[model samples]
Target: MNRIREIFDIGAGFENIIEWLTEEADWLFDFIALVVEGFLEGVNWLFHFPPALVMIGLFSLLAWRVAGKGVALFTLIGFLLILYMGYWSETMDTLSLVFSAVIFGLLIGLPLGIWASRSDSAWKIMRPVLDFMQTLPAFVYLIPAVLLFKLGPVPGVIATLIFSLPPVVRLTNLGIRQVPLEIREACRAFGATPKQMLIKAEIPVALPTIMAGVNQTIMLALSMVVISGMIGAGGLGNVVLKGITQLKIDMGFEGGICIVILAIFLDRVTQAFTTKDKS
Candidate 1:
């Protein structure tokens, strides 16, 4: 074991980095807790009154416009399933948590994606980080999340965000890279600055791919919603978790169905949004 360890150690200095990372993990956890608290409060504020229904209606309308009848119908079914399963409140809680987490993912992922697009060094640096993030067991994230954020929707959202962010960052970078060099050159020939080119040419062309990333991110986050509930994330997940703990198979199964419906609804809506023709 000693000989094997020495041979692999080389001069990488990984042991030192690992030690430092372990020490810093607590600070990272605290920061995540603070952000999650702020985000949950914001979500609560937005959905505080009847106005939330308005947002829901608008979302439905936008979804209908993009994906047409099929997706809209699916979304309606998802909404009704929540109401039917007696999981409306829990579903709403989960939805709210997911909303906040996805927003956080976008806020952080987009810039990292853009940076990775511009620099190969950034991509190389982020690649291993993303790999580690995804490969780490979901329960591992729950440890710090529970430690810093306590048991509730907030920690759940933080855990979901950490687990789900890599896909969006990677997809966004890939989307930007897929933009044709000729289009970029054409924009430059027209005296477009880097910012203008990115905003006008790159983003518009890359929107579909980025939307695909967002779609994947949302799906992954939703999948974790129920798991997170084990630590205090309310919603259908809580229902399902309760069922499991109490050995009530029906409750767990019903809750799982509700989640599946919600997942389909979200996927259709986001897909419609992404595929819509801007022209």
Candidate 2:
């Protein structure tokens, strides 16, 4: 055992690599952290700028427009419950983190998905990488994020984005590839360029599948944001963590209920887009 330990200390090797990166790439990491923090603050400001009631009404209106009266009514009731339970601010804080993460995720994922879909080589390269990313323990991501960006929503957003990114990329590639060959041939016969064909034919027909990916990304980001509370990300996650450590069952349960409510609202709204696309 001693000889084996002396021959190979893989954990230490990984730590050394992390330390080297931390020292050598401090400037780049700082710039990224600053950008994430700025975006987070902007989102927080927007969420907090209006009165809670006003924001609730806006969310309900959006739901009605996108999903239907049922979801809208549920949105109104759920948000009111959060407000009544004095969790409005916390809920918004968590929401800002998730929203920021999802935006960043989609920005990066969309391009990768498109590139992979267009090229066999790119798809081959990305497949294993995506598989590794998806299968790695979620907590492992937090370690690097924390070491690079420290505590708070900056690291939270970074971790959430990475954790949630794969689904969108995978689905986008799948969606584009699934576009009918006949449709592509017709577009080509009409002298449609690659870009035009992709935008008009492939993307439009594959929209529902792409939307499903977006929905999954949103769901993953939300779950990660809640977990990020472990590192002081704040919001309902903090509340739930507190309940766990302090044995406040009621508090924890309420926080969990809030999370469920938020998740259902987001899931339904995004899924509605896919439904509309199919229709």
Candidate 3:
């Protein structure tokens, strides 16, 4: 068995493919890195524009409006606690990372989801690919990402985006597929164009499920962003990474608390959207 496994050497073949892609894809990677860096910078600026307190208040207000007074109050207090712990800027940086990953994941996942929902063959192909993506070890993404984009938030973004994509795609496909048969038939009977029916009837009903997927994607991205910090993704992730490696328990704990606070805030806000129709 050992001899047969050694002879198979599938791992080496994958390594060779990675090596080839790394050597051949420099221009493509450079362009992607440029775009990702610019996006990160823009999002970072948005998060940093106002005073930390002001930004906290703004987010709190948004939470109040969308989620509820309880969530808003929690947002205010949690951010204030992070600020008091002196991790506010790092927290902002992490937010920018999560935000960027989610946006890109949605852009890629949503279209693929739509395609899969509309076509059986597309779903058949996408199922295995998405399953592979989700089931693969999260850190494995970092390996190729670093080879392609090097150590930084660019690779981090790439890794996080890929890690977080599957839930949104799968849930989106489910949501659309689950849209009622009657509504689709009624739309067709009304002589609604396919485009109009899809846009008007299908998506609206599917939105709650899709939003749930988005929430899951955000949570999943948060997990990867911290891991991505090992490659210089920056943000609170690096703080936690340094704290652990250097044995600074207080620092590690503080960084972790901030991440938890941020995660809860985002999770609550996004989850609230999923409950909108129910409410």
Candidate 4:
């Protein structure tokens, strides 16, 4: 049994191949880093552009409009708590990271999902890939991400994007597939072009499901953003990490409460959007 296991041991070979690729792929990594950095910078600037107070006011108003008074109150309290805890900047940084990941994830995943919906072969190919992405331990994404982009928000964003992408694609595909065949046929009978059918009939109906997917993507991105801080992503996660390193239980708890508050706020807002669309 030992001899047989030795014969099949490919770990060394895998390591060697990875080492070779890492050495040879410097240019690829550099290019990716440049693009990701640009995106991160842009999102960071957007999040920071308005004074924090103004941003908070706008967000609170949006919550009231979309999610109702209860959620708006919660949003106001949550932001205030984070600000009072002196983690406002870190919270903003985390938000920027999550938003950037969602933006990129949607840009790529939505098109792929739509394509898969239209082609059986494409769906077949995408299924296993999405399964692999979704089923893989989230931490595994950071390994290659760190290798490629090194430590910082770049790698963090890359990891978050990869980790959060599968849900959007899968949901988008499911949404389109779930559309009633009768509706499709009626559109065809009405002489609707494929583009027109999709834009007019299919997408409108699928919007709720797609938005649910977007919500999931955002949540997953937020979770990954926190974990990515282990690699120096620098956000509320960093504060939490610092608390852990220093054995500051109160600090850790404070950071954790802030994270939970933010999560609830985002979850409520997205869910509200989904519910509103459905209604």
lDDT of each: 0.82, 0.93, 0.94, 0.90
Q: What order do candidates take by lDDT, descending?
A: 3, 2, 4, 1
* Residue range 1-279, candidate 3, lDDT tens digits: 889878888998888888998889888889999999999999999999889988998999999998999999999999999999999989999999999999999999998998899999999999999999999999899999999999989999999999999999999999999999999999999999999998999989899999999999999999999999999999999999999999999999999999999999999999999998556
Residue pairs clashing, model 2: none
Regions more than 4 Å wrong, model 4:
1-17
Please, what is the TM-score per model? 0.86, 0.96, 0.97, 0.94
Q: Write the per-residue lDDT of candidate 4 for residues 101-159, one digit (tens) a residue.
A: 89989999999988988999999999999899988898888877777788999999989
Clashes of each: 1, 0, 0, 0
Q: Looking at model 1, which ten-residue stretch has the lowest summed lDDT? A: 47-56
Candidate 2 Cα errors over 4 Å, as ranges: 1-8
TM-score of 1: 0.86
Task: Give lDDT: candidate 1, residue 142.
Answer: 82
Listing every candidate in turn, what is its Cα RMSD in Å to the true structure after a full C-alpha superposition?
3.8, 1.3, 1.2, 1.7
Query: Candidate 3, clashing residue pairs?
Result: none
lDDT of 1 by residue, 15-125 (tens): 555455557676875676787788787786665444434545765676688889777766765666666667766666777888888999999999999899999999999
Which of the two candidates, 1 or 3, achieves a greater TM-score against the reference?
Answer: 3
Candidate 1 displacement at residue 26 in angstroms = 6.3
